[model samples]
Structures are given as structure tokens and as C-alpha cells.
Target: MHLEETETMHRKITDGVYYVGVDDHHTALFENLWPLPFGVSYNSYLVVDDKIAVIDTVKNIFTQEWLDNIREIVDPEKIDYIVLNHMEPDHTGALPKIAELAKNATIVFTQKAAGMEESFYNVGLKTKVVEDLEELSLGKKTLKFVHVQFVHWPETMATYLAEDEVLFSCDAFGSFGALNGKHFDDEIDMRMIESESKRYLSTIITSYFKFVQRAIEKVKGLGVGIKFIAPSHGPIYRKDPTWVIDHFDKWSSPELDKHVTIIFGSMYGYNLRLAHTLKKELVELGVEVKIHNISYSTMDNVITDAVRAGVIVLGTPTYDAFPFPKIWAFVNEMEGKRFQKRPIALFGTHGWGGGGVRKLKKYLEENKFEILEPNVRCRATPTEEERQAIKTLAKNIAEIVK
Candidate 1:
């Protein structure tokens, strides 16, 4: 690779179709993904044909590299259109700079996306707002837009190239890894990318799955042969677009495994021991069980499993007559997201007067979860008798599901 090509990995997907993938480091908002600890990538592409079109721009910090990438493909001034699949800064932060470079290029986006442009950059830029299923001609090539609202954002949409069978999926089917010399889905590490993709979808997009299901159906209805899926982040899906479609299909459905997720926060070992007992008894009843110590587990992963499991059991030791702070924070986050219609059971280790279980039960009921019978509470460290009582509670949970 030449110095210029190394700086910007630009490859032609087919005759007259090229994509420039840029790397970005976002340390603040996406802290959970970093340094190979958790990961994220900001991807942009440039298409060169009879008329040049730049798909999306990278972050402001990567503006120079992004612009240089576009320049390598074609003179920025010759670019005809800058497609805005999403208005998120990770994708649109360099829009103003790109607009300045691509002087006369028209900005194509949904109506809501056009409105978002003002918030991101100063006024006075030419923009063309297209509605759902609207098609625009770029010389011999044409791109169509499909409105996909609430699949993370109101202005989000998927751009389809009629001739190439490629879909520029914004954040809808993206993962959390940077592409290292590899651009196509089949060429890269499948297991790692698939796991990261699931983490991203489960944590960030799980709440709006119904809209995602509708969007999937919409894409399926188009009857277009999607040979490539170029998302705004992670490696582009070229070999298998159906892989992402399958993932979205499974996640968007309400289907869940016959497993129980028991999450708890305990200052001492009392609540922890109770959690183990509950898991053991549930396992004995032929139910798959997962136990997470809240103090150690990341909230994002915990919530991901919670959303996938059929039953959720929360155990928190009483602190100042209320649930532990970590548990409180977790529940607060779940409530803010409007989590609904799941079976939940609450238990706590308390001293003196035990009001934490009752308090938690009330809050759980308010959040639309069906509170199972008993809502088991143990006084301080559970004795053998208390352990036996927990076994009965686990049986009740199994019966409730059955």
C-alpha cells in the first residue's frame, strides 16, 4: 500500500464503487468500549462513478483524515452528493468540513435529518430532504432512502444502491470493532464481531426492538438482493448481509430462553449466599440459571442478559432501610428505559424491620413487571431453615413460568 493508500484504506467494491473506512477513538461516551477492553469504530465511505457521492463523514477529531480520504478518491469539489444516513456526531461530526470541501455537493437526508443539521453546524448549507422510499438520480447510479424511525434515532434511514445491491446501514447493524486491513464481513473475525454486534444491539437498541422488527420487514419487502451492508461503524458486511438480518430478527422478537438471571449486590456475603441457593434450587428444577454479582458486573451486560432471560431475580441487602445503592441505581436505569411485561421477583437480606423487599416490590409493580408470589426476604444471614424457604420460593418461580 502506498503512503496515501495506507492513510486511507480505499478499495473498489465493484466497478465505479469505492469505500473509504476511517478509524476514530471516542473515549468519553463509549467508555465501556475501548483499548481492546471495549471497542468502537467510526466508518465513512466515498463512492466514485460518473458522479461522485460521499456517504457519511467521521468525527470532528478525524476530520482531516476523513477529508484526505475523500480527496484521494476524487477532488472534493467534484463530489455531487453527501448522503446523511444518520445525524449522530460519530457519523456527521465532519459534515461541515466536508461540505466546505465539497463546495457544491448537495446534502441528502430525511426531513428530520435536515432539521438536525442546524443543531450540528452553522446555517446556510444546501440540503435536499427526501421522504420515505424517495429515489434520487446520480448520473447513471440511483440511491433510494427508506425511513426507519426509532431504530435508535428518529432521523435514521437506510440508503440502498439499486445497481450495486449495497445498503448503507447507519448504526442499525453495526458492531464495536475497528477494521484492521479487512473490510468485508466474511474476511474479518466473525465470532468477535458478532458478539460485539449483539452487545451493541442489546444495550443500545433493545428498547426499540418493535420498530427494528418493522424495519426488517420493510427491508425484506423491498425484494432487493442485498449483497453488501456498509454500516457507519465496524467492518462492512459484504459476504453475508443475511447474517445481520438474522441477528436483528432474533433480537427483535419477544422470544426468550427458559433461563433465570439472578442479579444481586451484597456488602456482606448474606445476600450472595442466598443468590447461590436460589440458583442451585432453580437449576435442580431443570431451569438454566445465571448469577451476576452486581458489584463486579457492568450494568450494560447485566441488562443485556436480563432482557434475554425469561425470569429476573434481584437480591439486594438493605441499607438504611432501603435497597443497596448499586441496586437502586440499576433499577432506576431500568425504570427510566420503561422496561415492561417481564416476570420479576425481589428478595433482600435485611436486619431489624425488613421493609426493603416491600419497597422494591412496589417499585417493580409500578414498572409493569408481574411480581411473582412471596417476593422472598431473609433476615440477615439465612440459616438452613431460610435456605429451605428459598428452595420453596424457587419452586414457586418455576411453577409460575410453567
Candidate 2:
């Protein structure tokens, strides 16, 4: 019904701002690729200032629920501003409908949104373009729009509230899981959210890492203090905003985790043995290690570990003169993400020939990976020398992970 009447919805954030967002518990896939087993949340906010301002809109499918959230705070017709941080359908799919609800609401976004507004929304925009460091006052509260291009989209921006020290980040610190009841990061189980947050960053924000780095730097460069990060997705960061910011900076930067990831595919268990052996060796060397059997794990899961790991060891058997199909698929996906420069250790079992190993070497080399010394090719089984070779490879891999 309405926010004022309902007790379960519309959690308050600070005195003036309230969380007017909805959760999609049924959506199986996000962006039509990544699985959303925990579902996802499309976070919207309501600022009850001298003039009511609504920050971002939700998907068209959730229009009524969203409108109900808005109605709980202030009348939709009384809303004065609708701030759009990103033009993705998830955030703007209901723009036309919302525009109808708040006929006098002004659409505020970055200048880049000008060229693509009509093309994406197909509705005439009553718009005001914000500059690099633009500011607007809604009486006592102030809103600042900072452009963060390629944080998944070119027209992306983040809205900052100077009075409350809250940053309404578009999707910078967002995760994939729906907020079942937990709205803030401190309110939920941090351990459960950590993995989903990493998956979100690795899947959605991995491609634009350079911009992600630049965006964080640019926002911090502004010198405006950020106390709470109310992103348009997932939980808001109120307990410690720096925790998420630090997480973003660490993940977006080139400095990866000091860990080893072993992605392997085996035809007859020889390559499997090689993978486990390397895992044991790396663990003994005090380096964190994660292993994935490609046959059982998805490519997304493999990429999740490999991207953050400083060293990647691929173990697979030759099949039809190429690396195992699953392993090939995994590498191909990582290649699409432009993975490069990390130390790669390759070892596998080949039945009759060594063409698969050579091809893998060339592929990684082409991608400019730093090839470790002695990438051994086991002949269908682990020999005494092959076992020692793997041990040496493990030591080398641990050394480079810093």
C-alpha cells in the first residue's frame, strides 16, 4: 500500500533520506548472463527536503511497488526532482511511467545523457545537464553529481549529499543479492554478502576496471567527506563506508590478492592429480589456493577466482588436439575480459602429442602473460620428475604473488 501505512518497507537512512527501493526475488538472471540465486535489489531513495527529490527510478515491472514506496513519503505529484545516475534499463525502465506520476519532476543527469536519452527512453526529457562537479540545493540539503564514465555505462554518475555526508553511488559498491530484510551493510551478515559483492564486481564491473579506478580517485579527489554509501543496488554502507570504498580501490587496482587459482579439466584424472598436487604444494608454501574442476564449475566461477589471484595454474588433458573443451572455454572467457600480465603456470597430461600444451602457451603468451619457467607436460600420468617439476612450479608461483 503506502510507505507511511506499511511497517515492513521504506527503511530510514539519516533524517531526511529514506530507502524507497524494491527487491526482485524472482529474477533468475541478471543482465541475462550472471545467475542471481540470491536475487537482486533495485535501490531508490526519497529525500524529504524543502522540495522532495527522488533519486533514481526502478524497473518498469516494479512501478507500482516503487510508486507505493514514494507515496509513503510524499505524494508523487508533489515530487520536484528525479535524479538519474545511470541510464541502464534497471534504473530507468520506469522513467516514462514515473514521469507520468510526477508531471512536474525535472530529470537531472550528466551531459553525456543528452545524446542517448531519446534513443534509450523514447520519451521527451525535461532535463537539466550536470557538469563535472555540479551542485544543486533543495533548501537545507545539497546534491552534487559526479560523472563516473564507464562504470558499466558512459552516462553513469554518483549523487552526493553534503549535509548528511551520504553518497548515492550509482552502482559502484553494488552487489547482486536482494536485500531480504537487511538494508545496510552493518545490518546483514558481512561474510555472506562478501562473496556476492565480489561476484558482482567480477562479473559486471570487471571490464571497466580502469574507469572504476579513475572514478574512485575522482570522487575522493573531490574532498567531500563520504559517511554513508547508498548505492542503487545491494546494501547501503553506513557502518563503515570506507570498507566498501577500500574494497573497490583494492579490487579495481592492478594489485591482486596474493593467492593461487587452479582451473583444471581432466579426461582420465591425470590432469586432476596435477591440479591437486599443485594445490597441496601452494598451500604448504603458505599461499592461498582455490581449485575448480571445470567440468563441475561454471566459467563465471573460474573467472571469479582467476581474476583476483596473482597466479593462475591451468591443468587439463589434451582432447581432439586442443586443450580440454571446458578449459578452453574458461580461458576464452577470461581472454574476452582482457586478462593479462599475471604469472601463468601451465601443466597438463597429453596422451600422444604435446600440441595442446604448446597452443595454450601461445595463447597465454599472446595475451602477454609472464610465463613461469618449466611448464611441464605430463604424459597421461604423473612421473617422479613430473611431480618434482610441479613442486618447483608451485614455489615459483608463490614467489610472484604479491
Candidate 3:
């Protein structure tokens, strides 16, 4: 079996490395939770040398396409290695099929990932468990592995190709958009990638921010010259790989943008009015402001805005003597995602009682959020006094963000 004498859709990263990933414009939601407005790509790569290696695999649904992509470059049976950097289905979904075809291929991954193979696909294939900073020779090119656990998964790792200087960084520096016809950073609109990358980090990996920081540091410590960063998703960073690296570092860092995000859940128009008024006031004070009605907006965008803002203002009308369920769920997501501690302002309205603001403040405080003063509680509509209190809250927020 040798390289097929056929035309292929696969794109080249360098002389020997090729992009065999597939784009999914059909999956409306990623993980059945986060919205995929721009769709996404399940990236896979092939490095052809004396010993052929296939890094990562596409989603299960695209198994045939993926195999065809590989066959166009080289016979599947000729593949000497099938590397699984993470156990997630999106990356390993084609594993069962590929392992069956690549009879001579050895599946390589970390110890934890090896243990998960059976539970995931039950494919009784030959395996080679690698360790942290381990290196494997592929004739002229060398593959190096780095363990970056809890980078959204317990068994996640990254692979580096020495000769071509490419890093197969599973999901470390990934985004949400599909590559489409363009595969390199220089070939596409970076603005869309930037925004989508932020949303991706916030919704997909924000909970593992600490591990992300560590992973970035670990990759840096490798001291390898990475000309390209081929992840399991999104575009390959070849023109300016450091640009994505800096972005990952900045997003995971403690420093935040000097902006305000107002999230409100209202039963009637009262809380919405309050949220609008607050946004107007903040804008008037020359502070950047983003407002979202949690009931109308999706969680992906809401969480993305919430994570980037320096200050967060939550407004919710009382329901069943508690914060509105939507607002409560948003707050709970913040806690579950381990949102960085930041100053927060709480406000809401009630028909019979005023438990919304109090409950929200308590929960936020318990989560280490710095509760700003003037937890405004209104009844039905805002009177002149309540409006004045809202102004005060806006001023306080402006001072902090500005």
C-alpha cells in the first residue's frame, strides 16, 4: 500500500503534514448546549514520513469522509500511528473505524486516555501509552507529547512535530468556527476568529482556566519553535502562532477589560427598564457597557460577555420569593465555571416581597464575588428615589471599570 494516485480535498500544512479535518455546518449546538452560530471543525492531521502518523480523528459522523481523506494521501493500512490527544468523542469519534482499517497502526495516548478507550469505543486495538514530555521518532520528524490534564478533560495532551515545528495541540488553542476553504490564520478574517475564540473559551473551557494557564506555560517551557499550531478544531495558526497563544494567555489571566455587563431577567417590563437605564447611565459615564436580557439571550453569548467584563450587574425580578429562575441559573453557571472574583452589583423588583436581590447577593458573596453597595430592591416600578439609587449604582460601576 502506498500514497494513492488520486486528487484529495486535504490541505497541506508543510511538505509532509496535511489537514484532513472535516467541517460540520449541521450541528446546531456544540455539546448539545453551546450554540454554534458559525459551526465548527473537527480537525485531524496526517504526517507522512518513513513512518506515517495520523494525529486525532474527526467526529464519528464523518468517519467515511475522514477515511477517504486519509486514503487520498496514503493507504489507511499503511498508517503506523494513530494518536489520540483527548478522549472526547469529537476528537476520537472516528477511532473505532480507523483502528479497524489501520491494521498496522498503534493507537498512542496518555495512560488515562488508554484506560478510557475501552469505555468509549471498546476497540480492542494495539496501544502505546506515552508519558509527559515523551518523544517518538517518525523517521525524519519527531513527535513530542505534553500532558496538560483538565484542559477541559482529565486526559488531554498536546503533540509536537520537531522537524516541521508543528504542535498538534488537541483543544488548547482552539476556536468555534469552521475553517471552510481557508485553513491558515492569514487566509481568513481574524476578527471573527477572535470573537468566536473568546466565546469558545468562555463557554467551553473557562472552567479549566487555571489548567489552561498551566498548559500554555508548559508549552512555552518546551522551548520548541512552533511554526504552526494544529489543534482538533478551528484554523491552524501558521502566520502568527503567538497571536493565538497571547490570546489564550490574556483570556485566562486575572486581568480583565474595563467594561460592564448588565444581565437581567424580568417577569414584566420593570427589570428590563432598569437594565436599560443602567446601560444608558454607564454609557453616559463613558464606560463601555453590554446588556443582555437573560430570558431572550442565549447562555453562550451571556457567559462570554460576563467573563470579559470587569464588573457584572445582575437584575432580576423576584419570583416565588427568589431570584428569577433564569437569573439564578446564570449565577449558578458563573459559580460552576469558577468565574474570577469580581465586583458585582445586584438589583431587582418584587410584587409582594423582596427576596430576589437578597438571595442573589448571598449566593454571589458565598462565591467570593465582591458585592457592591446599594443592593437596590424595588416594588413594581421604580420611583424617583429608586431611580436615584440606580444612578448611584451606575456611578459606582463606572468608577470601577473606568
Candidate 4:
């Protein structure tokens, strides 16, 4: 009801439902989910009934408040199950503390989640492994587990309540904004929630669209009413479950447009000028082009463009005879994710030996990318001749897309 109340963690949703979305002050590298915007909340839920069940737990830093929230509803010892829908640290960081609180409760998760629990926490606790479509009865309500692997992690899952038609969707169908004394989906501005939700999904869950689509299809087939979708982040999707599900459907489809993304790091502004010239030439040739400065652009945004673009062009000014650090890191991350089957080109302005283009080309080749022939590279500054060469290369990129 009050924003200050949510500061200490509050509860909402149905009469039997409660939530403890703990504030996480992670910064730069840790706090942001996937894309690293430096703010987020690790949501945990307490489903009160004849046999109480805690849907998920928060990060270790918020364990005390997490327990206090549980204590407010019912004694921790009375909790019958701790349903683990995901094993990521933000969601499972307080497993040890939660295990201590719910001493008699069994940790309900998929077999993969059970295996991951050992890696997450060193605590010894009893775990009850469930497979796809496995149902666990909790007095009047029954929770069904559906394995949703590779949405982000192999151990991820979603829990459904048969009687209430509520879905405990962990990490799926979630947003980034912290709750402001409102827990249900309908209470928040749908436009703001949808925008944040799209950003979060595009940054974190873009790569695993196939698996996410499969999970969505499986859930749809269950014929559950799905009146509410209580994800483990942001606001709960109680008002419009279909809104999030439809978003996943559209994002996961392979019907995106053709475009070119040029990511580069320029120290002296010469390389940036070349990138801009190339973008202009490409657009003149009737190609949609998006350019990003590696130092300022987020890799998540790059990845999102990469998924929809037909070509990826990397430009970098040589730094100690190698590509720029951000450019190198970007390539390494994309390579590790096995991002392939796209045409790639390299361009750069180097002062001395001009090694950046060669090094980037080798890296893209090793990463199994279809290297476009005759990449554009300029030494020091581009002359009119070199500018013409870049324009030609842009045309080549457009031709490849066509």
C-alpha cells in the first residue's frame, strides 16, 4: 500500500500469496541481470496454505529479511516445501539460510536444479527431485513442475498451481523495475512494465529463444487457467499473463528484419569517422545500418542487434598491436556464446603496422563466421581513395545481405 512498506519487503496478490522482493544493490558487474544496468531485485515468494510453500529465496545479503517475511506469515518450521525454479545466485544465494529456516521442508526442483544446488551452496539439505509434469500436492493446492532448460540456465523451471491457476514462472516473463508497493501486473503501468520486460528479455534471454518457445508451448498445452504469472523478478503478471506470453512468442520467432550492425572502438576519431562513412554508404545503398561505439555500447544491445542483423562489422584502432580491449571482450563473449552463421567484416584505422583488422579477421574466422572478402582498413587517416574503398565495402555488405 505504501512505497516505504515495500522498502522493508511486503506482501500482495491473493489471500494465500505473499512476496519478499528484496532490494539488491549490485553495481557495474554483479547487480544488473545479464546486461549490467546496476540495479535489480531478487524476488522470493511465500505461498501460505495448509502446507506452506516458499517459491524462491533472495540473495544471501537479504536472507535475514527473507526469513522475517516468512516469519510474518507462518513459522519457518511449518514450511513444507522450498520450490527452486532457478539456480542462479540472485535466486538461490540464500539457499543455505532458507534451508536452516525451513528445517523440515524438502527442496523441490528438477534433477538438474538438484545437481546445481551443490555448486551454489555447500549446505547439506534434503532435496526432492521432480521431472517434467511432476505434481506435488499441498493440501488444497497442487504445484506442477515444468522443466524449462536453457531459457538462461539448464536447471531453470516453472511451477504451476492447478487449483488457483497461478504460474510461478522464474526469470521468465519478468521485468527490471523494482516494485513500488504494488505486486500484481495490473497495478503497474502496462506500457512501462512492457518496455522494461522487453529490455530484460532482449538482454538476458535472447539467445535461448528456441528453448523458451518450447517452454511456452508446453505451458500453453497444460490448459491451466494461468490467471497469474508470479515471476522471480519485478512485478507479478497477475492482470495479464497473456501479455508476457505473447511477447515471448513474438521475440522467439525467426521473422526479424535484415540490418547491419557496425561495432567499433576508436581512440583517435579516425576509426569513428570511417564507421560513420560506412554507415552512410550502406544506408545510401538501401540497407538499414546500426552503429555502436564499443566503449559506450552495451554488449547486450549488440547481441540483440546481432540476432536480427544480417551482417556484423567490427572496427577497432590498434592498441599495442591488438584490438581494443572492449572490442576484444565483445568478440570473446560473442564467440563463447557460439554466435555464428552471419556474415562478418573487419575495418579499422591503424597508425603503424595495421594489425587490428588482421587480428579481428583471424578471430572471426576461428569463431566460425562467414568472413566477407576484402575488408576495409585504413592506416593513420583515410584519404579520398581509402574512403572510396570503404564505400565499396559497404556496398559489398549490402550485396551479401541481399
Q: For each candidate, what TM-score against the reference?
A: 0.94, 0.93, 0.96, 0.89
Write candidate 2's Cα lDDT for 1-402 as tens digits.
353554237878999899989898767788877888888999999988898888988888998888887777788888888898999888988788887778888889887776677788756647888997799999999998888998879999999999999999988989888886679888788886788888888888887888889999998898988889999889999898988888888877887788888999887788888888888988988889989999987666778888988888888788888988888887887777766468888988887876777788998888888789788798877789988898899888878873
CA lDDT of every candidate: 0.79, 0.85, 0.90, 0.79
Q: Total clashes, candidate 1? A: 2
Q: What tens-digit string does per-residue lDDT give for candidate 1 at 18-69? A: 7676755445445343233444667777766677788887878888777776
Q: Best candidate, lDDT-wise?
A: 3
Better of 2 and 3 by TM-score: 3
lDDT of 1 at 49: 69
Ranking by TM-score: 3, 1, 2, 4
Candidate 2 lDDT (Cα, 0 to 1)? 0.85
Rank ordering of all candidates by lDDT, starting from the highest = 3, 2, 4, 1
Best by TM-score: 3
Instruction: TM-score for candidate 1, please give it.
Output: 0.94
Segments of candidate 4 deviating more than 4 angstroms:
26-28, 31-38, 189-195, 254-256, 399-402
Cα lDDT tens digits, model 3, 270-378, are 9998888888989999999988999889999999999978999999898999999999999989988889899999889999867999999888888788998788888
Off by over 4 Å in 3: 1-8
